[model samples]
Target: MKGHRGSILDIAVVADGQNVISSGQDGTARLWDSAQGACIAVVDDSYSPINAIAVAEVGNAVNLGSPKETPSNREVGTEGKLVVLAREDKSLEGVSLHSRQSVFDFEGSDAFNCCTFISSVGVLAGGLDGNIIHVDITNPKSAVETVSWSETPVLSLVPFRDTYVASYGNGTCYIPLKGSEQVLQLTGPNRQPVFQVAAWKKLVYTCCRDGFIRKYEIPDLG
Candidate 1:
């Protein structure tokens, strides 16, 4: 809430809807009570700035391993949720919402610019080094899957059906198909960085720096 010393870059509301987590340029990730508009606690801190934050509720199917020790009173409510932060320190860290413990801390090839959860225990983080790393949080020793389309930094990732759509700093948005190495680039919108993306039903929307909101219709996922 009022504790961040710099600009807040991203914020995600917990599944319970009562709390919100924020990543800031001040190099800290904080948890806040939404209803009371108060800072509950500082979730994590990196010496460098954090660019994005995402929250996901891990279902029973995933094995996130046992906590190192008992959770404190402040961490009791976050048992099933994970707060993920994309940091300028070239790392992607997942923290347990309730226990305030580290689920996994991974270093990437470069600073992570954005991140999203493809599933409860599955995460995707895009880096400035032009790599998108996918992690299976259920398995601590799981091998990370890396995907790359260009040398440009990936700025956003939006889930679309079985696949996901990604936007880059080079002003390109693409969808990578399964069973093939090919990527389909979305047409229109000149070379302007697309910063945010969202989806509804069978349509996808993107907001670009060119001052325009672009919409695209996605075919049946089936």
Candidate 2:
């Protein structure tokens, strides 16, 4: 809680819910014991500000690279987890939670603002130049796909049922359909930046800088 030197950017709850990972403008990520509010470890350090981070339980999807030694007794519910960090230095990095090792480090077009896990081995990162980069954990040497539109800064990205939702600085929200070139638009906000997006059942919600929460309904995702 008191370890970071600058403003905290994003935090992700660990699988056990007792520990959390937080990234900050201080260019580091820290793992904290939620119940005790104690800083357990400095999980990651970078040269630029980390804008966002995501954590997911990756079960045998890809090799996380072996750690030099055994894990500490303090690390819990981190056996097969992966953490992805989006940094202002145009780097999208993956770290193994259990071993605390770097899995992969990728550079994007511009500063990455957000990232999310779509599957066991699939990862998506959105950058300030409106480019979305997709990487697979198995072979991170190259990107699976990269898409750009509108040229506005991508503010947020989230996984829905089948596809993923992305919000932009131009106040636009789009759902990039899975396995198809089709993209559905959520109309409403004009030009205010859409900061966050969430999905519940068939409803998709967007938090906009215009000071309103907008909801869109999608009955069928198939």
Candidate 3:
């Protein structure tokens, strides 16, 4: 599991198998063969310490919720992409995992803290200025920004189910993936800042700056 030479900022497990990709403050992304614990590929990004990494299946694939019994002969094409947040300029870089090449770069208002790719809406980047930049990877030239309360810097962005959960200085907010504009805000005691938020199964976990990892059950909204 140890791949990067420096601090590992983020690690993402591919949906296909036992392979994991890690990004670090070391400015490089390394692909690790989890079964063998060996580094397979190193994607160099100069000295721009990478803060986040996400991997998703490309093209028309089986829905994530499908049962294992479903027969699938889907061929994985080399069309997946990786989104990285560079600490130096607070910028976001899109690199194709299949090609291992830098595809495009998007500038944000301030230093970007983290980023994640939304399967339906493109790449979402969180910054120090409390703004979220949405970049359409298919058309990198046209990116959009969604303004937010400017008091706190966003540290992490995690998309779960159909909502995007964002963690900042003192709380976490869940934004709907579509439809009417609405936000579900969860505040912590004494306004403790949350550093990271992750969603798995029907639970959401938040790592707080107060050195506590809290888990919240996601209520059925169906």
Error of 3 at 131 (Å): 1.1
Best by lDDT: 2
lDDT of 1 at 50: 93
Candidate 1 residues 1-222, lDDT tens each? 588999999998776667788889999988888777778778787798999988887856444445566644444356677888899988788887766677788888899999998887789999998899998876645446898887989999977787899998878998887667887788766878888889887888989999999999977544
For each candidate, give its TM-score against the true structure: 0.89, 0.95, 0.79
lDDT tens digits by residue: candidate 3, 105-159: 7777787887887774377888888887787765667676575754588888888
Clash statistics: count for each candidate: 3, 0, 2
Q: Candidate 2 — what's its lDDT?
A: 0.89
Off by over 4 Å in 2: 66-72
lDDT of 2 by residue, 1-222 (tens): 699999999999998688899999999999888877888888898779999999998878867767677765666787789999999999999998877789899988899999999998899999999999999988889999999866999999999997899999998898977778888888899899999999988999999998999988986856
Say which candidate scores most in TM-score.
2
Q: If both were scored by TM-score, which would come out higher, candidate 2 or candidate 3?
A: 2
Q: What is the C-alpha lDDT of each candidate?
A: 0.81, 0.89, 0.67
